[model samples]
Target: MNNLATPGMLTAVWISLIVYMGVILYFVVRGARLTTNMADYATGTFQFSPAAIGLSLAAGMTSAATFIINPGFIAYYGISAFLSMAVFLPIGAIISLIVFSKRFRKIGSAVNAKTIAQWVGIRYNSASFRLYMAFLSILHLTFIVLIAVGLTQVLSRALNVDALPALSGIVIFTFGYMMFGGANSLVYTNMIQALLKVVVAVVLLFSGYQLFTNADAGFFQQLQQIDPKLTAAFNTDSPLYRDFFEVVICQLIVGVAIVCQPHIITRSLLLKDDKGMNRFLWVAVILLILFFTVVFTGLYARVLFPDLMVAGKPLPLDAVMSAYVTTYFSPVVSLFLVVGLLASGVATLESLIQSISTTITTDIIAAFAPNVIGKQQLFVNRLVIAVMAAVTIAMSYQQLVNPDLSVGILAQNGVYASFSAAFVPLLFGMFLKNVPVQAAFSASVAAVVAHFGIYYGRLTPYMETGTRNPGIAAALAILISLLVGAVVLVLYRQTKKEVAV
Candidate 1:
């Protein structure tokens, strides 16, 4: 809330942002020139290297949450939060990404699928089901809002501007360029952003080097001196990392299903062919592991701001990282860090805008009004981005003003529910043949119902808190979806056998 940016820092940030915007526009123009139709916009005609696409994947998958937001959880809860967020979650997610990418790419490329919704609908051989999945994709707006808010938090502090104007500028600029660029520009820009992020990640990770070396009691001991809970494996004081179930099991489930999102999974389609798959996976996994470790910087922030205050004002969870960067670093170093933070959020925002707008245009609108599927589709997609921009601005403003601990909570709720529904369908569709559309549809519906039901209805002890863990809700929903799908499949098979007999 406090203005922490020096005049020099503010001037540097504005200049950097302007230069960054110009670079982005160059790519957008280049990519737009190649983007003739919806297919080209979705997958791109230009053949990109595996390493570039890998960087893009790592960038999109990490997002503002990993860089800007999740660290606040670590700042609040400590090693427990880090283990769940940085360690266990990534373990599940990396393995899932590795396992799912090849199969998903093979199927998606075969079907010429542009979005996850289309993949689901095509895999299930149901138009109505595809429409349903497309509509469900709107849940990703929550994530867009999360990134927008996170970016606003960083930019507002860096530019020494108010939140509203910062939020507006971010939404308009990112969405505007995204309307033109699609996958072509997205991959290239994300590659650059990922590289910047790698530098920033290293800087942030080592920022607390003095604390670790200078402390007589050592780092963990210093944390223990501050609060014994900070050094604990499971911080019972924290809602999210209170138990083994919450810390490990639920995160594992959510991590595996996290790839079900459109932006994350459809990334594989950017690859020209199967030969690049190994390089892509290796690059993505290694970079992502590094990005994930940036959350440890939150622990550093905690060490610095033990009371979590800047100039006597309490630091909001969302503002913690921004505050730390501006307060601790020199003006020039802070400028670089600020740009990296912006890149982290903007990278994902672009991917989300491209994927979600494509889904709405290609899968949802095209299904409802087949006439909108042709040359007019690109125009329609831009309109969709405009509408999304407006919605994101509105929602981001609300979250910026009034957050439930952090915007990450709201994002996780919507994002988790969406992927929870998609998980069973995508997994079954990919691995299990002869899967009935009815089974998939029923499972998706059940997952949605169970997720929201448990979350809002407060059916579990975890949900009883004001700030509930979306992971727990999503984990439950996934299990319920699997059970319901398996049951329906069994019944359908038995019915077929009886009829044959």
Candidate 2:
């Protein structure tokens, strides 16, 4: 029983293609006729409405990881992992909304800012700030691209096709849509994609609930039934469960790093006023509830289907999410799931491309050739965009070629890429005003070390043991980062007084 294919399912694939591609095309067309001003390219002129901004914010923050592997969290970690983000994420968004959002809007409106680099230059009066921000900009692009590639591959599987062609087509679609529409387009596209994904994921989650209640296959019972020998928590029997601290350490550390994410921060920059940021509180509540639903759906699917148990033990990253879509639902519905994946991937990549273009033109190029103008900069920017995309595509495909690679393994790289670059600087910028430019520079070095420590030190052990809670390890890393930062502040003060006298 190939089980993935049915007449109804085949119709689903085509229908979803039409619907998903149409929405994405609409997304791409939003900024097609704009002038070549850097302001126009980077921030969409801040003309997007609040609803559009909120919706896009919702969509842009999610990626293939949310759709594909988020469920893996529930399958492995139980429910509390969901609760931490449930509480933390909305609070994070609210803080952004009430505190950071207004400041960002006022600053952007006041200065006609284009990118965070431009803001840094204005705030710090330093070319070095822009240079540092630019490199950080490239780092955002890498993870964004990584997530997009994963989404496209998963979407292809939903269509019952090889992933190579899907990657090519999706990238072309992403490139064309984003290259044309720029930020303005992304605003609207994220809105559409977000709503679409939320609605679809929620519906499926509820259906999964019904499957658990009305049907006889709820997750725990199904698990008990699926394999009796599988009994026991990480400590009791499973090897991965033996080191629960590692899981807690990894996830919590990842959460702490989440504070610095540029993709998330960019949303703060797009707000119309401080009020919108406050409004973000309600938005955060809504999104987390939806996110929890999606996670549980994956967990439920794990229980419902035992055949996905790869090698009689291992489960694929898309194990529950993809299998549930293709195995149980009609093909048309599965196609919509594919569409969701594609939309998520494109929205993510579009933002990445925009960030990369801005960083290349503003940070890297203008430095060496301050006088460089117009058509040439466009050429250079496009060149950078292509080169960066090519690298991301290569990195993602290398993993895909080796299907033996688990989503969990690839996801760890995301944890490293995300936290190390974005977290420390953003935190320092907010909390530590007295730290000198050199100290800020040095903190990134410290963060890089911390990133490796968490990755090599604790996360590896947790992963090997299949431990669910990585919280303890995360707290340690953040604490270390804070202590190191304080030491930097004190040392800088001593040096400053010596120079002044």
Best by TM-score: 1
The estimated TM-scores of all candidates read: 0.98, 0.83
Question: What local lDDT score does residue 59 receive in model 2, on the 0 to 100 scale?
Answer: 69
On the 0 to 100 scale, the lDDT of residue 17 in model 1 is 88
Most lDDT-accurate candidate: 1
Judge candidate 2 at residue 320 and give its lDDT: 48
For candidate 1, what is the lDDT?
0.91
Least accurate 10 contiguous residues by lDDT in model 1: 1-10
Residue-wise lDDT of candidate 2 within 94-119, one digit each (tens)?
A: 44434544554566567665666665
Predicted candidate 1 versus true structure: per-residue lDDT over 32-103, tens digit per residue: 998888998999988899999999999999999999999999999999999999999899899999999999
